[model samples]
Every structure is written in C-alpha cells, then in structure tokens.
Target: MSGHHGLYRPGSSVLHRLPAQVKLVAALLAVLAVVAAPRHQIWVFGCFAAVVGVLVATAGIPPRLMARRLLIEVPFLGFALLLPFVAQGERTEVLGLPLSIEGLWSAWELIATATVGLSLSVLLASTTSLPEILNGLQRLRLPALLVQIMSFMVRYTDVVAGELRRMRIARESRGFEARDIRQWPIVARGAGTLFVRCFERGERVHLAMLARGYEGRMPMGDASGAPWSAWATGLSLPVLFGLLALTARA
Candidate 1:
C-alpha cells in the first residue's frame, strides 16, 4: 500500500538507463515466453529462471531483496500448493497417502508459471519508475481511460494508506482494543469511512485537475535517450526465450 518500491532507483546500471518503453516491451515478451512454455518441461522452467537470474544480476539488484519482494505473490502461490489436493487427476500413493497424479503435476505447473510471471513483474517494477512505466504503457497504445485510472490509482494509493494509518493511530490513542473478533465492526466502519474519504479526495483532485486544464490525459515527457547497449540487452531476452522454447519442444 505504501507504493514505495514503484519508483526506480537512479543507477548507472544498463537497465536503469534503458528506455522505459523498450523495457516494458521486453518484459511483456518475456512473460509471453514463460506462459507459452509447456507445463511438464522442467528444462524450460530452468531456462526462464536463468534468464531472470541474468537480468537480476545485470540490473545489480540484490537476490535477497528480489526474493523478499517477489514473495508478496505467495498467497497466489498457495493456490499451487492447494491444487494437488483438490484438482481432478489420476490417483497415486505417496508415503501411504493417496493423491492425484494429475493434481501433483498441475500443482507443479502452477508454481512454475507463477514463479516466472511474478519474478518478471517484480523485476520490472523494481527497475522502472511507476511514472515511466505508465508512460510506456501509453506509448504502447493502451487505452487512455485505463492509463488515467492507473495513474490516479498509483498517485493516491499512498495518500489513502497514510490516511488509514492516521485513523488507526487516532483510534488507538483512545484505547481502542482489537482483541475480540466481535470488535471487527469497528474495523469495518473504519474501512468504510476511509473509502468515503478517498472518494471525497478524488473529487477534490478532479476539480484541481480541471483547473489545471487536465482534459482526461496526463502529459508525459519523451523517452528519447536510451543507449544502444540497453536495447541490445533488452533484445537478448526474446532470443533467450526462443532458444529455450525450441529446446523444450525438442
């Protein structure tokens, strides 16, 4: 909710210097490649992981930081762990316990897919500033409405979170105890109040935008200074993915 990690840290690394649009496109291609990979192909998953590893290394991001950041997606990863119990599949026995063979395979597939997708997404977010990434999306021909919504959402998320924090602190100052399950109504009311406050804030922000001549589109600076080496590095992802795909198919 803090949205603290959405901004790119200024660095001399090749990734930081790359044009945002190029990086975005390359990230999309990498995601597609990972998605297109066959479920049972362990080698293909390894290849995807290797490509991500190289990118992480090249970008000079710490492995521990990447792992911690990416771990935010683990709730969805839990679905992978659960699939082996609920998924329809051939029956098998392991350690005197019965399980579905197909379910186990499905679980593995889900984990691999989620790991690759989430890792790539986290890398993108970590390396690119939110504004730059949004601008890149606009350049890539995303609809204006979608762009505006994303922009506003990103801009106000921190504000909303700060408001929630202040509200909680104010409540706690008066000896509000959240020790009972039945006291959840207080939390619910607080959340509802926050929603109303966000709405009012949005209205004020809209009026301010109108005063500033914002006609539903935010102006963005041109990204025209990417070096050739950055593009070269970005292009390598697709080539690596293609090679991996071929290897998996073979």
Candidate 2:
C-alpha cells in the first residue's frame, strides 16, 4: 500500500485506470501475438514496439524508470549479439569480422522479440500494483496455490532485501571491506547468516498469521469490476497486434 511499492507509478492516465485483470490479459495477449509473429517479417516487430511505446507514453511512465527496468534485458541482448559470431551458417563480413548471415537474422529477431516482450511486461508492472496484480490473477482463475505463492513472495521480498541491506551496513560499520577474493568467505558467511535470519522471520510471520485466523489462503477482498468499455480499451492494442501477426503469417 506504500506509494512507492513495487513498480506501481502514481498516475491517472487511462492505462493506470484500467482494471488490473484487463491489463494482465492485454499484456499476455500482446506477448503471445509477438511470439506468434513470423521472425522474417521484422517490420511486424517494429509495429509491436510502436504499439507498446504508445501505451508506455499513455501510461505516463518516466523514461528514467523505464530505462532502469529495461536493464534486465542486457544479458539477453549480450547473448543475441554473440549469436552472429557463433551460429553456423552462410558467412558474411561486418567490420572486418566474419559472421553468419543466418545468425544476423536470428539475432535481429531475438532482440526485437525480447524488446517487445520485456517492454510489455515492464509496462504492465509499472502501471499495476503488486496487490492488484495478485488479485487480478486470482480473478483470472490462475491456480490458487500459485497465486498464493506469488503473493507471499511479493510481500516478503522487501523484508528480505532490508535484512540484507542491514547486514551490509553492519559489515561496513565494522570496517570489513570485501576488497578481494580473500574476503569472499566473509561475504559468503554473511549471506548464510542472512538466509537463517530470513527463515526465522518467515516462521514468525507465518505463526502470527495463523494465530490471526489466516486459513490456507489470504482473503482477497472484492474483485475490481471491469466494464465493457474498459475491456475494449485495454484489449484494443493486443487485437491489433494479433491481426498484424496473423497477417504476417498469412
């Protein structure tokens, strides 16, 4: 419920106003359409990116925040870049380096698809609160156990992170600087201590919840209602993407 919790940006944009379930489905559909699209038709991926870009703009997401979140894709981008060098196929020269022709095409497709997919996910998370997302999944008939697990993970991740941070500060205060490999054992022990503390904290939390009348599942309050207009507005982009993908396949 904190103002800065997770990736939920405070805004009144139409994207922010849409029901969480609607946004979830819209994102899923858009990702599926991106995956379904033929790899050779690179223009289709461009169109997909354009659509997601417009939505991100409409959502009023800050470029800095988006850029920071997009850092998650750096590893995937690196792998894609390497494809041109390692993949076996017809060879071509670029900047005096011989590369596979097929690898170039494959890399392009990988980068494009990854960008679109990750963007859609980032957009969804940026607009929807973690609690709202969990509620939305419950409404969407996602498995009860799976939803519950996700809910707990989201709730405790911050606590675990705080514990780790405090441990780091304590180490720094004691003048224990991890400057080299010799200090790595100390770092590993710190990590092990953090794990034990997190485990104890989780046990205490579970016991408290049990004593407070928590059953196997957390009580989700009333589901947010989605009107027809909301559904239509939310799904418009995905429908367009789907049609384009189908057209490209045809």
For each candidate, give its TM-score against the true structure: 0.85, 0.90
Across 7-100, the per-residue lDDT of candidate 2 in tens digits comes to 7787888988888999999989888889889999978887888877788899999778888998999988999999999999899989999999
TM-score of candidate 2 on Cα atoms, chains taken together: 0.90
Instruction: Rate residue 18 of model 2 by lDDT.
Output: 86
Per-model clash counts, in order, read 0, 0
Candidate number achieving the greatest lDDT relative to the actual structure: 2
Q: How do the residues 64-111 of candidate 1 rate in per-residue lDDT, one tens digit apiece? A: 888888777778878877777787868788897677888898888878
The C-alpha stretches of model 1 lying farther than 4 A from their native spots are 1-8, 223-232
The runs of at least 3 residues in candidate 2 whose Cα sits more than 4 Å from the true structure, single-residue gaps closed, are: 1-3
Q: Quantify how close model 1 is to the true structure by its C-alpha RMSD in Å.
A: 3.0
lDDT of 2 at 197: 91
Give the clashing residue pairs of candidate 1, or none. Answer: none
